[model samples]
Target: MINVNQITHHFVLGKKGNKTIVPVLKNISFQVNQGEIVTIVGRSGSGKSTLLNLISGFIHPTEGEIIIQDKKVSEFNETEFADFRLQHMGFIFQNFQLIPSMTAFQNIELPLILKGMSENARRKTTADMLKKVGLEDFGEHYPSELSGGQQQRVSIARALVLEPPLILADEPTGSLDSETEQDLLQFIRELNRDLGVTFLIITHDDEVARIGDRTIALADGKIVESGVFA
Candidate 1:
């Protein structure tokens, strides 16, 4: 469903004349098939996050092309990518990334609202999402009012409310306790199994990596290994 073809990314440090180019990702190529959970695992400074950002269109790749669902997204400008993202991609971040002032219901409904869905339709969709995430009763609660697990569930609901085909998650279980991490992983599996949603997850934990159908390991900005998880 997604392809990263020979992409290279670097950061220019210092002023123009004295700038030093520090490469973050070098010659990275991979593919994520529809309905598969592919996890990218790497240590700090491995450029895993950079790869995710590039794929998410938060940042353009310095080189190479990114095709998603057959669209050459790498060539899209910010406005185009923003619209495409809302219609095709979902995101789950480690910190939940919820608006503390907005109630869970409002947070989940935001995407639908942005899509210009009628209030009645958005309300129904958001409510259904909250139920799917097991947060039906917590809909009125704000981010600060919920536990870490509950907040993450709300984040998942918000991401899935639009029913995007692909979900890109960065360190999804990073902030949770072991039990909560396992719970969230199982929930992710369920979402993939029941909804046929494809996942591309970035994680450093082995336990987290084990849940993937395949794992790609990166080191020094290169893919050192890619294989089915044993």
Candidate 2:
């Protein structure tokens, strides 16, 4: 589970010598329960991605506390955050962030490689994940050789291969067509249901938000609305 309390973030933008503070998130607070799918919906500049970044430990909040599984991570330095992310969080991006030169199998295997998992273990795990994502036959193909949906499948497989407890997806469906988007969302839902992996997804799409167990609406860096959809 993840808990964010009274978090605020801002950045300095301007010349090197002269900078102006631009706020991104304003007193944002939320909690994600175990085995639940929570969506943060917002338009551009609404700070949805900033909130996700804060949660994922990509960037710490300027002020406030971020507690994951009972540990306060808001004060963690970059090195600590990097270790935490590898151990606890899986990330999916709108761009599918796959390595261009790696084949599907290799791409999915990268995390395990980084973790120093045994070659045999990585092979078995990566192959099983490929099958789980319905990419069993395409592991040998490079990203350039696959369709958009297939490439995203590879990306999803990579994200899940490590079996991290939490997945932080940012605009996961932005690059897909409507049909593919639905399929991908349904796959995510099934993954949540079957694996009990908690998900916190950030997106601007209402349809995407509707797929979650609960939706938190954000605007102007604040939570405007939040509720579980029946």
Candidate 3:
């Protein structure tokens, strides 16, 4: 589902003449097959998050190509990427990234609204998504009104509302307690198996890594190991 070929990214620090280039990812090459749960694990400063951002099209790769579903997305401009993302990719962030003022129903419906779906269709789709996430009764609650686990479920609902083929999650279980984290991981597995959705997750926790069909480990911006979890 994804192909990261010889991708390299670096940040330029200081003014033009006195600048130093600090590399964040170096020649990272990997592939995520359709319907697989692929996790990327790394320590702090290991560039795992940066790699996710690049694949998500939030930032362009400085060197190589990122091909998703056969499209060379690394070459797309911001507008093109934005449209493509809505149609093909979904995202889940550690912070949930929900609008505090909006109810869970509204948050989940936002993507459908953006896609120009009619209000009736949006309501039905969003309602189904909330049910799928086990948040049917919490639809009227705001982000602040829900527990961490509930909020994360709402976030997952929002991401899946569009039924995008690929979901890119960064630190998905980072803020949850151990039990909640395990629950979320199991939910992710169910989503992958039941819906045939592809997942590329970024995580630092070993427990989280264990849930992956395959894991890629990074250290100092390079892939130190890549293999099946067990």
Candidate 4:
């Protein structure tokens, strides 16, 4: 479903007069099949999130290619990338990037509205997602009003409401208590099993990585180990 080939990324920092190139990823290559859950485990600076951004088209690699299905996203311009992301990818951030001002339902409905779906369809879909994530009664709540776990569920619901083919989750359980984290993982597993949503999860927890169909460990911007857990 996704292919990243020899991708290298570096960022230019400081003014043009005093620039520095900070390398992030180096010659990375991998493939994720449809309906598979692949976890990327790494320390804070190991470029796991950078790799996810590259694959999801949030950022382009300094060199090489990123292909989703058959389309080479590396070549897509900003507008094209935005369109492609909306159509094909759902992103779940560690910080639960929900809008503080929008109600949970509205936050989930925004994507469908942007896609020009009718109000009735958007409402139905968003409602169903809220239920799926166990947030049915909290639709009217704002982000600040919900507990951390509830907020994260809202984030997950917003990501999946559009039914995108792939879900890119970065540190999805980073802020939750152990029990909450377990619940979220189980929910994610159910999503993968029943909905067949492909997941590329970036996490620092080995236990989290084990939940995937396979795990890829990264260090200093490169893959050090990749295989199915025993």
Scored by lDDT, the top model is 1
Q: What CA RMSD would you report for each candidate?
A: 0.8, 1.2, 0.9, 1.0
Model 4 spans with C-alpha error above 4 angstroms: none
lDDT of 4 by residue, 1-230 (tens): 99999999988999979999999999999999999999999889999989998888878899999999799999999999988888888989899999999999999998898889999989999999999998999999999999999999999998898899899999999888899999999999999999999999999877789899999888999999899854
Give the local distance difference test score of model 3.
Answer: 0.94
Q: Write the per-residue lDDT of candidate 2 for residues 1-230, one digit (tens) a residue.
A: 99999999998899888999999999998899999999999889999998998888878789999999887999888988888888888998999999999999999999999889999999999999999989999999999999889988998898898899999999999999999999999999999999999999998888889889999999999999999743
* C-alpha TM-scores of all predictions: 0.98, 0.97, 0.98, 0.97
- Native-to-model Cα distance after best TM-score fit, residue 196 in candidate 4, in Å: 0.7
Per-model tally of clashing residue pairs: 0, 0, 0, 0
Q: Candidate 3, which segments miss by more than 4 Å at Cα?
A: none
Candidate 1, 1-230: lDDT as tens digits: 99999999999899978999999999999999999999999999999999999999999999999999999999999999999999999999999999999999999999999999999999999999999989999999999999999999999999999999999999999989999999999999998999999999999999989989999999999999999766
Superposed model 1: Cα runs more than 4 Å off: none
- What would the per-residue lDDT of candidate 3 be over residues 95-166, giving only the tens digit for each residue? 999999999999999999999999999999999999998999999999999999999999999999999999
Candidate 4, residue 68: lDDT: 96
* Residue pairs with backbone overlap in model 4: none
In Å, residue 175's CA in model 2 sits off its true spot by 0.2
Of 1 and 4, the candidate ranking higher by lDDT: 1
> Global lDDT of each model?
0.95, 0.91, 0.94, 0.92
Arrange candidates, best lDDT first. 1, 3, 4, 2
Q: Model 1: clashing residue pairs?
A: none
